[model samples]
Target chain A: MKLYELIIIGAGPAGLTAGIYAARKKMDFIIITEDIGGMTKYSWDIENYLGYQFITGPELVEKFREHINEFNVEIREGQKVIEVLKDEENFKISTKTDTYFTKTIIIATGRRPKELNVKGEKEFRNKGITYCATCDAPLFRDKIVGVIGGGNSGLDAVLQLSRIAKKIYLIEIKDHLTGDFFVINKIKKIDKVEIFTNTKVVEIYGDKFVQGIKIIKNNEIIELKVDGLFVEIGSIPNSEIIDFVEKNQYNEIIVDCKNRTSHKGVFAAGDVTNVFAKQIIVACGEGAKAAISSFEYLKYL
Target chain B: MEKKVIVYSTKTCPYCKLAKEFLKNNNIEFIDYDVGEDREKLEEMIKKSGQMGVPTIDIDGEIIVGFDKERLKQVLGI
Candidate 1:
């Protein structure tokens, strides 16, 4: 087992940016992730990423990939990191397929879509329920679909489904749509869409397939007959696999301004960290910080 | 009618890409119904498999969900 200088455990904005920086600094590092681009690929449209006024999530990810491709960075795509731990002076990174040893580690494992924990939610998973709008919007074409969560993710689903589904039921547990003004304004013009605020999904009902979803709004329980349900309530940090590191209540790894974790040499970055603002550009900066910090630490050793 | 191999997929699904590649690698000619492009095919897909996940393969009425390699091998006899 060849031990590298650094191991970054994600391929999202943070991990990719870190890889590019590490490569430029001539630091030997490897990125292990289940997929590249992470949740950014699921984004319908991105307007806030600096240098581009507007670009689709996939398009932005493509640009990132192209930028990283310029460097001879080693990215082990399609590999899921299962466990990460300290091995004396080096860190042991474990994936489903293999284990790697590195002097430093950067955890950029993003987040997964939070599941709607209701009755029949799990039974109907992949049956008539999905998470990624970019991945499953087409499967619900011309069918009545309900989207859970009123944030940007739910709005993203609505924007994507508006062109595909026959009708959309945007169910938000809050009192109002909490997405950006641009997206909120766009969906407002679509007559095929219905927005329900201050509504909570209490139960999901079905037999062989998803028949409908039960909800409570204004103190009234109502059953909505639909073909599919998309849970986009938000996400929890992907940091549960490694408990040796300090984490917040949301399971996000605690990191300092320099992206250093509680344990020396084990760094954390991106949405998996305690960073309040989980954005692509922000993650990139933090990733670079983690890489540079790791580089500095490696120099002393 | 010949034994048809149809793959109901989305444009962005990784499993769908793998399923298509798996079929192509086995010299299996399959009809790709991209749900993202063809709305009608999407409805047909949901009706048949009762699944929303992409890369649902229909081999002459035998439906397999996701990129199940072992199941694909069994169904295609490859």
Candidate 2:
């Protein structure tokens, strides 16, 4: 197998940024990701990322890809990294169908959306309770739907569902809506969205197709009849594939300022690390930091 | 009809993997093609479904896109 100076996992903002910097340095590197865009591809619009006043996450990452393409960084898309092991002097990275040896590895496999553990949630996944409203909103056109959570994604789902669904129940577990101001304002303008703060989804009742959802808010339990339910509470890191690495109680890898892991020659970045914030910009910054640190570690060897 | 299962796919697609897994889990055999690698088949896929995305499934000529596991199970009677 060919050996690389560095190997970067994931292709999200963090991974892509790392690739840009690594490529600029003319380092021998390869990036392995199942999709060129990670979970951020699901995002429709992002006004927070710097440089662009407002742009879609996918569009921004496209620019990152274009920049990295200018260099010789080998990109292996449609491949999921199955294993990462440290050998005597090099790290062994294995995918489902291929293997590679690298002097250093950067783990940037960000987080994935958390699932609603309600009964029938999985059974009615494509049938009703969905995580990506953008991907499945058309399925509930002119139908009643419920959106759980008060985060940015939840707010985005409410706004999108408001356009397609006849009635939308925006349920939140907090006393106040916690999404971006613009999203909340947009959702407010749409009278179709029924805001229910401090709400908890107890169960998802459906058979073959989604029929309704049960929620508890402020010591009061209520059932909202709907055809679809979109769960957007939050995300948990995608660390299952690398669970062998030392991680915190929350499953985030503990990395130093340079993104070095407990194991030598192993580094991690992005949402997989115990970073203060889990934003696209922050992940990208961390990815750059990790790549630089990986370069320094290579010099020591 | 012996449950005609047809998988419209691209040569390089990861979503097609999930769709194939769905068929395999149900023990349903399917005929698939790499439309991305074949220009004629790519046009056929677009014309048949008017979709530009890959991993489109045709169960008894009913069109579906992406993995769409649930819809595949329902249409294929899996």
| Model number with the top DockQ | 1
Per-candidate DockQ values are 0.39, 0.05
lDDT of 2 by residue, A1-301 (tens): 7889999999888888888888877789989998876877666568998888887655675677788788777899889998887778788888999888998889999988898787778677656676776655644567798988988888978877676688999888889999988878878888888999878888888765678988888778798999878889998887776655689998999899999988888889999889889888899899999989988888888
Q: Candidate 2, what DockQ? A: 0.05
Per-candidate TM-scores read 0.80, 0.73
Clashes of each: 0, 0
Candidates in order have lDDT scores of 0.87, 0.80
Write the residue-wise lDDT of candidate 1 on A1-301 in tens digits: 8999999999999999999999999998888988879988767568999999998776788799999999988889888888887788788888888999999999999888788788898898887888877778877768899999888888988988999899999999888899998999998899999999999999888887888999999899998999888888999889977889888877889999999989989998999999969999999999999999999999998
Per-model fnat list: 0.58, 0.00
In model 2 chain A, the worst 10-residue window by lDDT is A132-141
Q: Candidate 1 lDDT (Cα, whole model)?
A: 0.87
DockQ of 1: 0.39
Kindly give the stretch of ten consecutive residues in candidate 2 chain B with the minimal lDDT sum: B9-18
